[model samples]
Target: MSKSVLVVLSEYGYWAEELVGPLEALDEAGYRVDFATPTGKRPVPIGVSLDPEYVDPPLGRSVTTAEMADKGRRLDASSRLDDPINLAAWLPDRPYRSEPDFLRRQEEYFRALAAELSKADRYDALLIVGGSGPIVDLANNGRLHELILHFYRTGKPIAAECYGVACLAFARDQENRRSIIDGKHVTGHCIEYDYKDGTGFEGTDFVIGPPPYPLEYILRDATGPDGAYIGNFGRETSVIVDYPFITGRSTPDSRLTGDKLVEVLDKGLRTWGFVPRTGVVAPEPAAAGDR
Candidate 1:
């Protein structure tokens, strides 16, 4: 049977390669891919992501390849994105605590969620493509959290890159409401790669501030005590495969992230990248004295 993947995209804007990379790999592998959006709108690439001449502030070079730019444009114009699964319509909503009959409604909501999660059976894995847009709608999305949990609970791989990985950190257990990634190894956009200015989502006009939060800081806190967040600072690429979770640091790791996910599915790949307590250490914070 051909494998199927459920790919979630942010409606505001997704990094061009973040979606294109894995998409090409998945297509080459002959996998059936489906799309979903928070509100059923077709996802567009963040403008700069498709511009080959845009120099990345951190990398100090153009990250977008001309080929990638063309691919992104053609894909955006294609009809494949015409109709995405409407997350709001497809998933169950949680009732507010102050709503009438809160207890009954909450229970019903959960019951409905359980039924909705059953749809994960149609997929072999989950991929959340990333960009600044995810901050607007995909992260902290309760409906999406439930979907991520479903794939996780069923032993299926869940891959996320850049800001999309934030969803994994927030996809908590309903009862504990704690991050599922608390004890898992993962990677995401590190502080060093965060833009110093002009962080914005395509869906909104608030376009001149840095990302509201540094993903590296959140990943560090989320994977505390037992787990580790590997940023691989100064490395050209960072993609961690810790069984059910496959995480990529940013756009540079996009294609590799997809290739790793393919290995996880095709060859039973279990663990890759940093081994804790084996002389491996996460990047350290500088002391005030060091400055």
Candidate 2:
């Protein structure tokens, strides 16, 4: 049977390639994908992401190819994004303890909440698409964290790219207050790739000098002593699959991230990037051209 995946996007703005690359790979593998956003609003790609000649402020070169730009533009113009699942509406609200009938109400609320989270069972995996936008909303979203927790607890594959990896670092259980990725090997945007200036969210006027927080440092601290963070900054690509958690370093690793997720689903591949202590080497995905 074909697997289904839930793809979460940021409402601020997303990189076109970050979404398109994985989507193309998923499409080729025949997996059904459902898109969701923090609000009911349809997500939009950063303008630079859809411009073939647009030069990256940090890299000082045009990163998007003509073909990818065309694909991103087409996807953005489609009506498919019109009816995305509204995370705010679909996810349960957090009830306060000070409210009336706190204990009984909380019990009843949790029971319903569990049922709502179980909707994730329909998806074989959850992918968080990356861009500057995720830095604004997706990184610290409680609703998104609950959703990630649902997938993590069920042993479903969870993939994240670029800044989207921040979501994994923050998804924690209230009981332990530990991040979901507390002990999982993962990769994300490296320090070397960070922008020096002009970091801003779409649909807003404010522009920050750099990302509000350094993702690489956050990942390093979140993983703790047992788990390692692999930057692989200058490498062709970096995609790590440590069981349920799959992480990609940056935009270039997007397609490979999707491929590895498919491997985890189809071939029972358990680990990659870091050396496994079990001495059982994980199989690598088929080679493909760089994105």
Candidate 3:
């Protein structure tokens, strides 16, 4: 049977390469992918990501090749992303205790939540595409947290790249109030790659100077004492796969993240990047042409 993946995108603006890299790998692996957004709106790639000649502000160089830029534009214009599932509408709404129907509504909400979470059975894995956009929306979304928790509880592979990894850091069990990644090894956008200024978001007038929060610090704290956060800055691409949780450091790690997720689903591979009790040995870098 062909595996299916549920891919969530940020409404503001997703990095073209981040979405395309994993998606291309998934497609090559014969996986069916579905797209979803917080409000059901079709997500768009950051305009600059489609320009092969556009220099990344932080990197001070053109990271997107012409071929990759073309591919990204094609995917953005494809019908596949035309109508994404509205995650907010699909998931149950939270009820306030102060409401008159608090008791009854809370019961109803739980029932709906259970029903919605059961839908995870249809997917072999879940992926949250990353970009600065995710920092604005996907990171702290309650609905996204519930979705991640559902996948976690069901033992389905959960993959995230770049800033999308923030969601994993913040996804915690309601009862214990502990991060789902509390004791899991992972990687995300390290401090070294963070843009110094000119952080922009779609559908907003403000262009922030710096990211709202430092992902490295958040990931370090969220992983707790038992868990490890591997930055792998300026080294080989960083993609960590510790069972159900798979995380990628940044744009360069996107394809590897997808490849590892495929390995987890197809070959039953359980561990990569960092292993507990044993020290980490960095894997040989991918071939130059592979990027």
Best by TM-score: 3
Better TM-score candidate (2, 3):
3
The C-alpha TM-scores of every prediction are 0.94, 0.93, 0.95
Q: Where in model 3 is the C-alpha error above 4 Å?
A: 278-281, 286-290
* Model 1, span 1-291: residue lDDT tens: 999999999998999999999899899999999999998998899999999999998778898999999999999999988899999999988888999999999889988988888877999999999999999899989899989988988899999999999999999987887788887899999988989988877867888667998899899889877888888887677888888999998987888888889999999998877665442643432321121
* Candidate 2 residue lDDT tens string, 144-189: 9999999998889999999999999999998898988877788999
Scored by lDDT, model 3 comes in at 0.88
lDDT of 2: 0.87
Local error of candidate 1 at residue 214 (angstroms) = 0.8
RMSD value for candidate 1: 5.3
Rank order (by TM-score, best first): 3, 1, 2
Deviation in angstroms for 173 in model 3? 1.3
What is the lDDT, from 0 to 100, of the residue 224 in candidate 1? Answer: 76
lDDT (tens digit, per residue) of candidate 3 on 1-291: 899999999999999999999998899999999999999998999887888888877678887889889999998887989999999888976777899989899889889999988876899999999988998889999899999999999889999998999999888886799999887889999998888888888777678887999999999999888888899776758888888899998877888888888999999989887656553645645561256
Q: In model 1, where do residues sit more than 4 Å from their true spots?
A: 276-291
